[model samples]
Each structure stands twice: as C-alpha cells, then as structure tokens.
Target: MLRSSLAIATVTATLIATGLPAAACGEEDKPASEKVRVSGAPGAVKNVKAVGNVPDAQGAIAMGFLQYGHRDVMAVSGEFGLKVYDLTKNPAAPKLIGEVSLPGLWETEDTEVDVKRKLVFLARDPRAYGGTTQTGESGIYIIDLKNPEKPAILSYTKVPAGHTTSCVDDCRYLWTGGPAKAANQPADWGGRPIWVTDIRDPRNPKTAPDPIELARNDGKTDYVHDVQVDDEGVAWVSGRGGVRGYWTSGYHRDPVQGKVRRATAFSPVPYAGGGIEETAAPSKFMHNSFHPSGHRSADGADSNRWRGRDLIYATEESFLDGCVGDGVLTISSLQNSYNGEGWRSTPEKPFRLKSVGTWSVAGQEGSDPTTGDCSAHYFDVRGKVLVQSFYTQGTRFLDVSDPTDPKQIAYFRPADASAWAPYWHKGYVYVADNTRGIDILKLTA
Candidate 1:
C-alpha cells in the first residue's frame, strides 16, 4: 500500500530536483538490462476444478479477482459486460453468484472489491447507445457483492474507460482511464483520462467531480488501456493508439499507421531491426511492453489483510489482439515498432525480483517462445501468484522474494485458448478457461 506513496514521492522529488518535464525525465536507473525469465517445469498442473460454467462464453476472460472479510474468500470477474462468479464453495468450482446486465455494449472491463465496505465494483462501457463494438464504452458500473451467491446492481457512474483499472487504493474509489471524445466522434477513444469514483456509501456511490486525466492519452488517439494502482492509490496508467500517438514512450503507430510505415520501411527505415524498419519503439529504447503485472497477493495466507502489500503488475500491449479479446480491434505496433521492444524501463521495484535470465525457451524474433504470450505474470510475495492469460501461452509463476524483477519459477499452458489467468490461494493456482471451465492446480513447484 505504501508503494504508491513512494512512487508519487519519487516523482515529486524528481520533478522538483531536475525541474524536467515528465517527458524529459530520462533514464530511470535500476538494472534496465535484466529482462530475464528463468524456467522450471512447475510439473503438470493436473489439478482440475470448475468454478462455474457460462454458456456461449466466447472467452473465459477472467481478468480480476478479490477476497473479502476475515475469511477473505475469493470472487472473480470477466467480460466487458456482466459477469460475477462465486468461488466461495471452493477455490475451484465457483457457483453462479449473479450477473447484472449492462445497459449497452460494454468492453475493456475490470473489477474490484471493498471488503471493508462490503461493496463490489466492475467498470465497463455504459452501453447508453445501442451497443456497437465500434464506439467504445465509457463508464463504471457498481455492483454490491456482499452475498457472494447473489451480487446485485447497487449504482452506476458513467465515466470514460479506454482499458482496465487498479482498485487497491481504497476500494471506495473505482478508478479507470478512457477519454470520452465528442460523442459520435471517436477521437480519444481509450486513452488516459483517469476517472476515480468514491464508493464509500455502498448503496449510494457518487462520482467525485475532480478526476485525474493523464496528459499523453488526452491529446492523441485516446487510449489508457490498463492500470495498476498501488496501496497509496497512485495509479500507473498505460495505453495504445487507435491511429497514431505521442507519449514519453515516443511516437507510435496504430495498425493503420504501421501498414503505411512498413510499405515505406525499405525507403524510410534506414536500419534493420534497430531502425524505422523496426517501427515499434526500437527494442533498444523500450526494454519491455504489455503493461503486464498484478497486485502482489501479500495476504493469500492471511485473509484478514488482503490489502497489505502495495504492488501491481501488468503486461503491455501497444494495440489490440485480433483473434483473442474483442472490441475496438486496434492493430499492434509491437511488430512494427523499432524491432518489437516493449516497456521503456524495467520493473520499478528491483529488490522485489531475482536476477535470473530468460530460459532457453525464449523466442528468437521476440516471439516470446516461453508459453506464447512472452510473459506470464502474477502477485507472489508471501506465496501467492496471479497471472494474465495470453491466448495459448498458459499461466506462469514468479518467486516474488523481490517484487520488481520477478523470477519465472514455474508455468502451465495448454496448446489452445482454454488456458487463461490463474488465481492462487492456500498454495493452489485456480486456472480457468472458457471451454475448460475451471481447473485448480495445487502448487507442487
């Protein structure tokens, strides 16, 4: 929880000392060279358990989870629309909690729980107009998850949302980013227009007038795709453009721009992988991508204090995935960039991760040979790992003795889309897929 305060304090100090524009603040030192992924066969995750089965599930899309109260039971979330599953019966087969319908076609969703306040918050496009995947959704829907079996709609606050959000700050404020363009004009579609709502009163949550919008996402092709808020409530927001963009990450092209650039790469891109030919950020500049990280589950062992640690991890994706997640299919700049580079810097917290290098399984041409998704991440300090599902790339584990440079200790992936994010508790990782439903893997690694 204090991590956010530290980040903010650090930023404030840097701004004051260097007097440099956030854009000019260069070289965040702390082992930028350690983009490593150690390999260890976490054995075959034969453990199988079903949380709940939803019919016509295009994708399981289990993106977020929360454990509330002294028992600190786990509740999971998915889909851009309405989906609330109850995993209280067992960590594996979560019974049908309840589903609250969204008014319109909503996408780019995330959820959070205020165990202290007994409220659940899920964010999505408010679907005010007839839902169309073209026009993105922009709002946060409030759900009260007091009764795990029966979660009902408590309130709804219409807000802009480009990607997802981090709810570790206070559970009272459901924060999200997505610039609401001039209505029908989809200019700043999903950019950094960070909006925070105060949900102190579960029944009547109100939107706090003052919301923080990231400067970069606001002007360009708006798209604050994802965020990770620390315990101090300082949200680290990120995004990609629908067309073209300019950020501290430098100017980037969307699918539309990439195709144009590639056509002229031979004529324009002076160098090979390191030049315009490598359109992305030039692998040299951006060390990583896919804002991929998660909230360090420092309390999986002690349900009484789930919000103890102040860390969040998220993978980075410049544009959108074509075959996987739906809605506003923005093309990827990862391939077109300066040789497929990702994040501009390494993990902010170095002491948190081990210095193990990537395994031999790493891909040759930035293909992320490991599981397929290049990175499989989670929250594991006191023995807990959270993961992000990358299509066929399965789930991965990290020995979070150090939070920043996570050690790729173990992983499990199917050859198909059935493998998704894994939730760990009591030494078990709950792996769920659309077709596979849910499978609980007891950690033997």
Candidate 2:
C-alpha cells in the first residue's frame, strides 16, 4: 500500500507548512517526527494530472492543501488532521515524504500558508473538536517545514473563539471571520468579527487589537464571513451582509478619574454566548468596533471601507437564503490605516472596476455537500485563480485573470459528492471528499 503525506489537511490551509524540507529556515534547522512513507494516489494513471486520497488512515478526507517556494513542497489540511509532503522531485506524481497528525484537530474548515516560515496553519474544525457550541479557539497547530521527513511539532495554541480562515506572513497575525457559534447548540446565529491573533512568538500566540473589538452576525444581516491579507499584512475581512446599530446595550463602562470604568446588567447570552461570545466589544466601545467602514470603488466611482491592494483583499461572500448560503464574490483592494492614534480603522471602496461577481455554483457536476453553501471559498495564490468548493457544487475554478472578469476556466464535480474543500498544489488538486476519498487534479495554464 502507498504511504501518505504527513497527516495532511487542516494545518496547511490555516498557515503554511510545506514538508520537503528546503535547505533550512535561516540556520535553525530541524528534523521531522518520523520517517514518512511514500504513498501514491489509489489508482494512478500516466502524468497523473492530479491525485486525491484520504489524508490519513482515520479518513476524515483531505479538505485543504497548499504548496510553497521554488522547492515545491506541499502542505494540506483536512477534516481530521494536517500533513505536508514533498512534490519537488515529481510534481505530477508526488509521494508522501512528511506528515503530522492532529487527532482532536479534525474538521479543519480552512488553511493558510506562510512559505517563508516553512509553516502551515490550521483553523480548528468545531464540529470535530466538540461541536460548534463548544467555545474555544479551534486548535491552531503549526508544523515545522525544515526537514520533510523529520518534521517537528512547533506548537499548538488554543483560541477561545471560533476557528480562523486565514493567516498572513510576519507570522504576527491570523484572522478568523466566522461568528463564535455555540459550542454544541450552534443555533444562536451570532455575528462574530474577524478574530486576529498575534503569533509573533508562535508558542504563545495572543489575540491582537484584542478579541473584544467586534460583534456577531444577527440572523437578519450579514457579518464578517471571511478575510484575507496581502503581503503587507493588512487584513481585509468580508462583512457578508453587514448591518449597523445592533449590540449589547445593557452593559456600561466609564472613565473614572483617569481610568476606564465599567458597569453591567444581566441579559440573554450573546448570540452563541457561554460558548461563542462576541470577540469582547463592550457597549462603550461599540463605535470602536465599527470604526473602519467601507469606501467606494473606482469603477462605481464610489467608496469602500478601505483602500490600496498592497496590504489585503477583502470581499463579501454573497449570502442568500436569509443569510445562510454564499452567492457572490465581493472584490476589493485594501491597505491598513492608523486611525485616531491606533484606534485602527479603514475606509474602503470597491478596489476594481466591479466590486461584485456572481460565483454561484452552476454547470459543475457533483453531489454537493450542502443544498447550497460554499465554504473555504477563496482566491488562489497566483492571485489570478479563484478556487472554491460548494458543499454540493464540487471544486470550481475561475480564471481571475481580470479579477473583475473572473470567469470559470475549469472545474471538477463527482456525482454523489460529499463535504470536503478542494485545494491546489503545484498546479494539481487535492480534495478530502467527505467520505469518498482524497482527490488530486492537474490544472492547465
């Protein structure tokens, strides 16, 4: 039987950890945990184009994967685990060279990569860990990528909020846009802000700007659904269907003498309180929570909440069905601004000629996971490819050559599909299909 990449799944999607082991990160060289075996796709053909298989023996299915650097090592995160592999020798027919196992860290919703640090970050899957109701930062595991075969376990930080969708370089910040839902009874439907963490030390990662800087999405409107940062480390978050003027008003705080004072009153728990609480924005700081607003874009000759594409790209995921499913891909550029002396605010507008694009799943063949919900929906690394998988729509690829004119270039859908996100590795695709199997795809230029 073919061995596989180190665990493979959640870690790669949340941060960046390619296994092949480049020369070394600076001079701090490290070794992998064990000797990973060389495993191949179950039934491979010539050129292989792409291959997909279960990420680990447990079989949660690989959900996300990423590759980095001139060396081309691969890192993929999944439903139950995280792993990295080396595809440098054979990009087409990559063999498992390195791997990591995150037993309780399954249900990996998404991942992001920091190639420079040879690390892959994972956003914990609430369902797998305990349930959406259980509040706590989904486990954040970082994999050392110096030696693919002998990769080391860097550290796993516990986040008390929900899991994050992506992380930026500088390794200082990572953002999770999902609302802090109830740990087990996920029906509260709270709107959460983008939980940004400071991982400067990695071992003891802390929330930046503080977790108390935001609120959750109410059922009536959109909340911050997803986010991404640019090379400059500016965070662009999508306030799916943002609404204004709604918050916990019962609580109060005051500046007594020279210090900020506070008061409180009992109220129903925040959306997913007890488990998923609003980041921690107090009523007194409600204005602070909504400081950075949207500006108009050039095409609309309008404004958005931010500007400058150098630091980030924040787009609104079209949520339909009264704000449950995804509909459009809101496109815009971004740059961070220091406002009111570090109060942190951004005025934005549509960055491109068009700020909205219909990314509805159609014409694709597959048994989608949900009746209609796109998860892990995102723009690819080349910044030219928008890759996302609908729970039922399958893996859809759009040629973002024009960002504004993001057209479907290629797609893959399996009849009777399951619930796994699709990932791109060295022009190839890897998917942890709910229970079907891990799949690989080779995309054309």
Candidate 3:
C-alpha cells in the first residue's frame, strides 16, 4: 500500500495520545484544553477566539459561510463528516446546531453552500475513503440546508473524481475535479479532468458521462485540481499543468480562437489562460484559485491594482521534503494570458503565461522549520490583503496591493496548528485547521 504523507503520522500520534478517534467530533461544551496547539508572535494577529477543538474535529479542511434568513452558519468539512455551526449569535463561540455523519467518507475536503437554492455540496476524495491513490469511488454528497437545525441528504452522485467541487451559475451546475482518477480514465493521464454535473433539480442530479477534455497543457488531459467562479461569470480551473479560465455562460470573445463563441458548463469556451511559468513556481501543482470581480476586487487600498485587469490568485500545493521545496503563491495577469498567442500552443509549439509575481515563506518572519510540510494549501483574497493557509506554518496575511512584490502584513501560527485553508467572512477570518480546529482571528495593526 502507498504510505501516507509525512505529516499524517504526526497527526496520528496526536490522536492516539489524546484518546480521540482519527475521525470524530469534539463536544461543544468542552473547555479549551492545555493539549490544544497555539503559537504566534506577540504583535502579530492572533486568534481572537476559537470554538472547535482537536478532539472534536477529526481533521477540518474546508468550510463555507452562509446566511439563511436569521441564521449565519459555518459548514465545516473534515475527516469524520460535515458539521454546521451557527455563527450569528456569536462569531467566535459558534453553536453546533446540526451535522450529518458520513462514515467511511474518507475526507470531505471542501463544501460549497448554495444560499439561494438552500443546497450544500460535499466532496469525497478517493485518497481518504479508499486509502488508495489511483482508484476509488469519488463524487458529491448533496444536502438540503433549508433547515439549519437539521440537514438532510438530498442525493449523492458518484462522479469520476472528487478532490474538490464548486458551484457555477447560481447552483445550476457543478464542476468536479481531482487528485486521482475514475475507473475509465486514460491510463497515461497524470490526473483527473473537470467533470460536469447538473443539479438544477436539487432532488435529482445528472452528471455528464464524459469528462471535460480541453486538450489543455500541450494537448494532454492533465489533472484539474479545483474550480472557482468569479463575479463576471468566469469559471477558472487550476491543476498540475497550469491554471485556465472558461466562460460557462453567454457569448464572449474566445481568447484562443479569437472569435465570439457560446459557452456552457459541459462545453465552456477558453476565455483566458495558459500554462503557469514553471521558472516562477517551485511546484506546478495548482491547488485552487480566486478571482474577485469589479468593485469587490478593489476592496482595500489596492483600488487600482486590479481595476482594469483580471488577476488570478492561485495556491500551489507541494509536499517536497523540506519547506524550501514546497509550493508558493502565484499571481498572474489574466490580460497578459489573453494576448491572442498562448491559446493555440501544443506539444510541438510550447507557450506559458507571464506571472505578475510569486510569493513564498522560506525566510519570512516568524517562520518555523519544524512545521510539517510548509507549503501553500488554499487562500482567500480580500481587497489588498490575501489571507492564506500554509500547512504547519499557520495562517499568513499578505499585502497584495503590489502584486509584483507581496509583503507579509501579519500572521497567526500556533505551533500545533495545521492550517489548511482560510476564509474571510463578516469582517473576520476563519482558518480551517486539519490538526486543531476552526481558528477565528481578526486583522489588527
């Protein structure tokens, strides 16, 4: 059998010593324990208050913030199952109102909530459920969130691959992507491609029989890690080969064919993208992407930073032995990627997009060497500041007003925190820690 990642052993050790199951939730009333991890600089932004704990959270990876009428809830996806906490009453001390057990689920890496549709999509990855790399049943678990106090499963569609899944066009469809493969994938392919699913009918979902073969990256169907939809209705997919953008709806100028074309979830036309410049990235594994549109993209002091241009913020995830070999944050100019040259390149003709800048935490202040797998995982961009999760390095806040030279503004690293992703919500930052739990923090100068 293939071995687990280096950090998995450490996590196992902690679970054993604490007498907590590898995949179980801690009690809500339990007080903060001395065993919980916490480490950070005196002046840096620190956890204002944390609700979930180690024993309660098997391994929290991703979370979604939602508000239905009078309830503001946080949907946390972890090793054990999906948990929902009400944050409206108290943002820090979230009250656990509901959850659904997904035994043998492997891992719910990420969950997306459709506010209008009152639906939630949970991702089940093969790596966790089957404990294998290339084989297993992966798909999305649909849940009805109409009743926050009690969430019920609407349906489950077993797709080709499911490392991550996201909603497109107001919950009308979903783009599922991955770390491994389906039973019928091409033998020589490195990873899985984006599979489309129709969920217009919340009770009954339909998945396309075939996966999206864009012939991206030298005409090879490489893996697509994740998909993020921007306000302008552009769905961006990121993975090993590189990051690419697509217009899922409406007729737009095809950056590649240089002609206006129709677009849909199953057959999205190439909008803007090419391979990420390898020379600028330590690792080519693009984990996820974020693109803020119009006024939202210019929230902070970096008003003009992305005013007239489209900026693609991506997280590069790598498991290289030392921290130096891990992935970094890549910022690329979407306009530059659409210069009408990179869209048609193939193996015979190679081309890559220009990176606006790339940032890493090798020698950053407050960095720790003992941290397990110090690489970028996931991030959320807000205004000029980008809040990112760096495995064991903790949560970092960077100033991206100047994309070419990102500056570290603040950080929160508790020695035991294995922060996987960060989400900005209601003026507060919520960090999904794989080892600890959901850490709540606020930016302070």
Candidate 4:
C-alpha cells in the first residue's frame, strides 16, 4: 500500500514540477501525447462504439446497480459524491435521477448494493477530503434507494475498515475493508483488515469490535481491499497478501479453528485461498477478483478444463515505473489451497495457489508505452467474455473461455482514458472512468 502511494505521489510531484496538468478527476487540459487511441480485432469484438457518455462525470471511481420501480438503476460514487442514474429508458445514456454531492468522497472503488433492502453502501476511505491515512475518518454511508429519484442517506456508520464495503449473507451484514493503517492501529500492521458491520437495521448499523481475515500477508496483517461474494455464498477477500474465500454463514467445519462452528459475518470460516505466485503477480497487492463457481469451460477442445476446479480470476494492482512492473490479470487454481493454508502461511513456509494463466495489456497492440497508470483495476465476467478496466489502458474484452490463454477479443482505450472499472449489464458494457466518466459501449460481434 505504501509503495503504491509513494509512486503516485512521486508522479504527481513530477507532473506539477514540470508544469504538466496532473491527471486527476476533472482535469480537462491534457498534453498532446494524451490523444485518443483504440484497438480491437475484427471478429473478436466488432462495432465497438460509444453509444452514450457522461462527459462531465469526472472522478467516477465505482458503480453499483439496483432495481427501483422495476427499472435498472445505477449508483456511481467518487470524489464528486454519489449519483444515481436511470438505465432503464436508455441503457446508453443514463439519466441522472438523484445525487448526493460530497465533493471529496475518496476511493469507493467497489460500491455495494442491497437490492432487496433498497440500500446503497458508499464506502468512505480514511484518506478522503485530503486527509492522511494515519488520521482520518473511515466508515460507510448507508444510502436509501427506495425512490431512485430521491436517494437519501439513512446513516453513516463508522468502522475500522472502509475502503470497500461488501454485502454478505443477503445484505444482512457487511464486510468492510481497507485503505491503509490508521495512526491508532497496531504498529505491526501492514494495512487495514476487514471489519464486520451489522446492517440488518439499515438506519442503526453496528460494527464488530474484532476484524476478520487477519494476518493475510504471509503471517503479517496486511491491507484487505475488497470482498466479492460468489453464487455459493463464499465471500472472497482480496488484498495485499492474495485472495482468500470464507464462509460467512451456515454451520460449517472450520478449517483454521479445526472444529464445526457456526459461521457468522463477524467470524467467517476459511474455506480456501493462499498467496498468489510471485511470478504471476510480483506486486502483492490484489485489487479485486471473480470466482467462476459452477461454471463449465467454454472451450470445446478441453471441455473438462475447469469442470471440477475452483479458479479465481484476480487482478494484481500496482503503479510502477513501466507497464511491465504494473499489475496483470492472473488465473489461479484453488485446488490445494483449502484447509486454511493462507491463514497459517508464513514467510518461511509460504502457501501459494497454482497459477493457471496470466494476461496483461502491456506491450499489446494499442497500448501507450509512456503511460504509467496502467495497473489493472476491476473486472466483470459473462460466460466466456471477461471485461476489465486497466486505468489509462482503457477497457479490454478478453475471451476467457480458455482460461489458460485468455485472448483479447476487443478493447476500447481512448487518448485520455482513465477507465477504473467495467461492468456488464444487459447486453452492453458500462465503463466507469476517472477522467471520462461513464461510457456506454456495445460490441457488434
């Protein structure tokens, strides 16, 4: 976490020293080198066009979706606060139905939505409003989305972890995690861990005193970034160490504790996961991940490739000097990672998941070699196609049917593109960019 922060700060300082406009949320004046560029194969992804766009939607970091009045509604959060858009009438052009402008709501990269409860959890980073990580307020804003036209803030519950809040167990509770360690935290902590919050009562949420998923980074307590719950109700926690899965509910045999205990949101039982192989991901920081549970291989040649396997598609995010040192998409198999290997893993005896495959936009057909903001951010999967956002690299559509060798079927990277996260809703791809806002794109092929 410190490495990423240092690199970003150095880049910003250099840009300012050279009188160059620092690339941020709403910086309009860009250099000549920052021109629009796009690339894709003919058959892989055809007819890639921007159907609609929110040009002024700068600082757009993350997006969430919910249903209100039987219509698809999108809630986007960033430095400009949260904006709710109606995606029903026009999937391409979203109409801003409601908004909560907080000017400096920093880093809610993956917003959580409770569709059944009509609530949106806006994660508040400790570094929000030009505050330092050592001493800043961190928590979650429970926003009521009952009326899409008039979204209201139900409550702001304070928690130790708040870079991203994920709804687990049918939105009954939330697993809040990361930014960096605060001043009052333990001295040996690498970064923040996951804190459980009881959100059953939306207006009166309470955070657990203890944190889960501790000592994740090779026996050291590191930063826990985001949580993704799969179809089987397994909460996948991704961060500095690697990606790990836990059972948040039900009575299950605890692999770590070695007993049959009832798993709750606050006390989750480790299911599987471990450190990602260093070769596949040099940077220990994992941004986010997706698990293809019960998903069969789409490849006809090797139909049984992923039939009985638990594969995790993760992103190793890091902002280094060049693209090579940056993050990449890694396909890791959790075959032998079960039994709390990641929890008990130590530096002397490290436990790593098997790396099935890896992919990156670095040295690709249409990538800028000079751009430094090329780390992988967030991604979404739909059958064989995996759409991901690679910061300045734009959005990439990969054919993940063959997990071992993921091929880029299509991509959309403009000159000034700062694509943060890409989501697949309905039949189109919605890209949330820090500089370009929301871009609605459709594939012709």
Model 3 clashing residue pairs (backbone): 25-56, 26-56, 39-413, 39-414, 106-129
Decide which is better by TM-score, 2 or 3.
3
TM agreement with the true structure for every prediction: 0.54, 0.56, 0.86, 0.89
Count of steric clashes across candidates, in order:
57, 82, 5, 2
Off-target runs (Cα >4 Å) in candidate 2 are 1-71, 134-139, 181-189, 194-196, 207-209, 212-225, 239-326, 332-356, 363-376, 381-385, 400-406, 418-425, 430-432
Candidate 4 lands at a TM-score of 0.89
Candidate 2 lDDT over 194-245, as tens digits, reads: 5556666766677653343242222222124444433322333334222121
Give me the runs in candidate 4 sitting further than 4 Å from their true place: 1-47, 296-307
Q: Candidate 1: deviation at residue 317, Å?
A: 1.5
- What's the distance in Å from true for residue 195, model 4? 0.8
Overall local distance difference test of candidate 2: 0.39
Model 1 error, position 276 (Å): 18
Model 2: per-residue Cα lDDT at residue 102: 59
Could you tell me how far off, in angstroms, the CA of residue 169 lies in candidate 1 after the best superposition?
4.2
lDDT of 3 at 214: 53
For lDDT, the strongest prediction is: 4
Superposed on all Cα atoms, the candidates' RMSDs to the truth, in angstroms, are 16.4, 14.2, 7.0, 5.5
What's model 1's overall lDDT?
A: 0.36
